[model samples]
Target: MSANDTAAANTGSDERADFLQALGQHRHFLRFATRDLTDEQAGQRTTASELCLGGLVKHVTSVERGWAGFMAEGPSAMPDFTAMTEADFAKRVDEFKMLPGETLAGVLDAYEKVAAATDELVASLPDLGAAHPLPKAPWFDGDAKWSARRVLMHIIAETAQHAGHADIIRESLDGAKTMG
Candidate 1:
């Protein structure tokens, strides 16, 4: 191809690498917080919040999967948050707990799979600038739209935030700190 085409290709490659690197770093911190924990321990709530180690992993995985789907399929990929019922809210709350029979290993495995898929999607997307209106939610403006890149950034931010939460929970559980 021409020199301009080559430069554009390199730019896309660099952008994808940047996205993946940011995402992977946060994912590492999140997973690192779970080291050597038993399923029971992973499920145990250490702080006043309902969040547990495994539950955080599950929630992050679900968030990444949902955003990635939105990247590919627009607002329809997400449930209407404005229309959620009490049962729907209750089920969402369960995403922050390690339910009975759920293992840390299983939760981590699912997280790994979701992370891999998200990484692949970032690498393969033809255009990160492709935009979609967000699903109806009180937190979102009526006319707000997010590009694929914005969604990826949101995923990274969400992961990093929850990773910090996981670190605190893990430390509370056993004095183990994922970071200083």
Candidate 2:
């Protein structure tokens, strides 16, 4: 309609594009680290840390899904991290290991689905500035709130961090580096 309206629309589109591009790049690096790996190889722990390539992918998918839900549904969408039970902690630990019967392909497919949904949410969210109080957690300030944009950035950071972890695990497993 108006020139101002057009400019605002372009800015939003550009912002979303930038977010998607960063996410895609990190996802590529993470996935590349898993290339040509068998299920057992993907699951093998090559370092002191429990992280494996498939598990890192799975964990990133879960993180993206949870934060995307938080962006859409506020604090209600998040678990009470401050009240997590032993079982909850165990489940979280399982996210870092490829359990039996889990295949690398399956993990990667689920990550693709989660990434697609997050990308769509970034493009369709009405207001990236919309804010919500983070669920009560030891690591978060009690009064702090995060905007959708901030949550997206967190997801990107998480993915990128895990991608590096995956690369290290991969190199340790087979002497193959995702990057120099």
Candidate 3:
């Protein structure tokens, strides 16, 4: 390759690494949100909303897994929410709660595993610009599509938003703050 081509390649490579690092930084914030809290403490619903630190961990894990799966496969790979049974819907709601049989350690461990898988998927993609049709959603415009890089960016936003919520909830629980 010519020097110009090599420079372009290096720029693309650096951009990819920067995206992964940015995502990891937010992931660390989420982890910090749960630090030094017991399972009971993590599960405490200090806020009026049902969000808890441990539950945020679980939800972020599931969110990353779902998006990464879509990026790897396609929109059709996602679940058909309209067809979900009442029981399935209830279980989905419960997924945001650190219910019995769940522990902070277990939830964080699962989040870490999902993060590793997501990073691996991102790094191994041959082309992040590949596009896929979006799933049907009221919030999404008609006939919308997103590239693999867009999906990763969405995951970063989702994770960061929840990390902020987790921080607020953590503060309410024990006056602990993820940020100074």
Give the winner by lDDT. 1
Measured against the true structure, the TM-scores of the candidates, in listed sequence, are 0.93, 0.93, 0.91
User: Candidate 2, which segments miss by more than 4 Å at Cα?
Assistant: 1-12
How do the residues 92-150 of candidate 2 rate in per-residue lDDT, one tens digit apiece?
A: 99998899999999999999998889888888999999999999899999999999999
lDDT per residue (tens digit) for residues 39-83 in model 3 = 999888997898888988998898899889999998887776656
Task: Please list all clashing residue pairs in model 1, or write none if there are none.
Answer: none
Alpha-carbon shift of residue 38 in model 3 (angstroms): 0.8
lDDT of 2: 0.92
Clashes (backbone N, CA, C under 3 Å), per candidate, total 0, 0, 0
lDDT of the structure predicted as candidate 3:
0.89
Every candidate's lDDT: 0.93, 0.92, 0.89
List of clashing residue pairs for candidate 3: none
